[model samples]
Target: MLPLIDGKVVDITGPGRTDRFGVTCTDLGASIIAPNGKLVSVFGDTFSGRRVGQGDWRSPVVLIGMGDANHEIVYEYAGGSDPAYARQLWDYIHDDAASGWRRGGISTVIPSDLLRVGGSLYLHAIVNHGFGDVIWTEIWRSDDSGVSWTHLGEQAKFPADLHDGFAQCWSWDFDPDDGWVYVVATGFQRDKGIILMRVRPDQIGQRSQYSSWGFTDGRWQWGQQATPITPPDEHWGELTLRRTAPGKWVLGGFLASSYALGYRVVSSPVANMYTTPVQTPIVGSSGSQVAQLYGGYLLPGSRFGVTGGVGVVVSQWRTDTGWPYRAMQFKAKLKDTSKTPRTPDPVNL
Candidate 1:
């Protein structure tokens, strides 16, 4: 198995576009590579101009741009009425009347992660009951890239108590090799361990079709009750488990306990993450370049094997002053320590 030995930060993405995008005070950039070869990104809790009346402060908006917009996050306003601003996914979900928080009634239905399956884009979003409390999660889809969406509805909605709430937040990828969508999920608010699950791409809307990996009877079982892939060593926040290509995987996210973005080069979902070490390439700090870091979404150009490196999109929010709350891109240099190459599992998740 190819394990990441070490890594380094490459650069911040979008240049001045963080300011140019007009949506300041945003966090959690969950993205996917669209069929048109564009990097379609979604952000949570956005603020543009005002906070009420559908003018500004939109929760969960979409931004379409080139994956390699290292120079500037050039945008295409194909999803919004305004030809100049990024597209806000939901207009009905506006700021509350009193505190003006929770862009959708008492809570913001925020985007957790995004994935492209077949010709459509699917997004996993959390419905909140309060701070650190999730009521449920639903998957939404869009056929015309990020322009619009249709929710999978009540039948497909995942309850917050599902798997003891570990299924509240998710990051997933489609594996064409076996036609299964491998999912790695955790609780919101960074309070739980990671769990691995798999569902067919077509059956993603059906909760009964999902199967989880757990260590039971002294061996790994694909259809067993869900178990944390990582021991309760630390609290994990907003995770990203992506297959850069088939059979190639890298998993990481906000390590809430350490206040840093950490990752592991996982060979597979069932490849024993309990013992594998996590590498922290970017550390969060108050005086350093990155502060209050979270949301480690792997961009399109990220590589998995040798010549390893990941261009990840990370979010920074200054708790003291929320002005610097935005998403930036950083490349992590990877070190491989594999003595011999590994092959894909003939039988799958």
Candidate 2:
């Protein structure tokens, strides 16, 4: 785990607009280890414009983690402050009109989550028609560890309205016990509950191989009509589910109903979620220092097994100001018990 000091959530893109990472501002720093064994983080809605989300607007930019100071993330080729030299995984939809960020026209493809199977990295990204309205989601492959990519084609494409539009946003982790990829999906609009699905590792490219889990015939079984696994009236956004340790899983994200970011621990992918209460270590405030907090993707160094400090990247955006539209690293102190809150407010970091 990367050592975290103080409760301060430091910015990863240097000092923001003029940072040294060659990235001015970015959100959704979903970290994943690249095929080359280097730490990698994928960002959404990256802008190198003189202002936030303005100039050089690009969707889905990936960075190579150099260590955390270590807050530095460089481009795949090389990194610097110049936006023109910035390299992206693909040139699918890049617009730099400064005011041409129209949803339908620009085709803003936001990365939902990433997974590395064997020697390949698969990226699941959503194509947006407009805010909360997804056109479709596609799976892209990179055998050279993100240096290049190949669209897996219609065989791997998932409809935006799959599961009644609840399957647009995804978070997945491979389960070696059954050699299946366990995935939990919610609406990209942040307006729906969650459901579970599993696909054999080798059949990831075939949409037919993906089976939904549900409470059918009085037993939790796959291949049934997908049912909501979340509590009644609970809606989630931008969640991540990872096996932080052997047999131990951590799941949670932006809890839309409560307007806070929290996490819950479970023993297996099929664990009952209602009983495992949400622990909100970080709460969002309208104008607090950590204002407009949303993303709660677990960082690489998080240790959920023994109970200590867990590192995660949380994003903050000033909807009014546009800057501070970046992801920052934070460390939370937690004990083994899941009863309630802990230590003090600083531990709530």
- Cα-based TM-score, every candidate: 0.84, 0.85
Candidate 1, poorest ten consecutive residues by summed lDDT: 1-10
Displacement of residue 138 (Cα, Å) in model 1 is 0.4
Error of 1 at 164 (Å): 0.7
**Angstrom error at residue 305, model 2:** 7.4
Residue 33, model 1: Cα distance from true site in angstroms: 1.2
* lDDT value, candidate 2, whole model: 0.71
Residue-pair clashes per candidate: 0, 2
Taking the tens digit of each residue's C-alpha lDDT, what string does model 1 give over 267-336? 5666656455777764322245475678877766565443335566787766765556667766555543
What's the lDDT for all of these models?
Answer: 0.70, 0.71
- State which candidate has the highest lDDT: 2
- In candidate 2 the C-alpha lDDT for residue 265 amounts to 74
What candidate 2 gets wrong by more than 4 Å, as runs, is 1-6, 14-22, 68-84, 94-106, 283-289, 305-308, 335-349
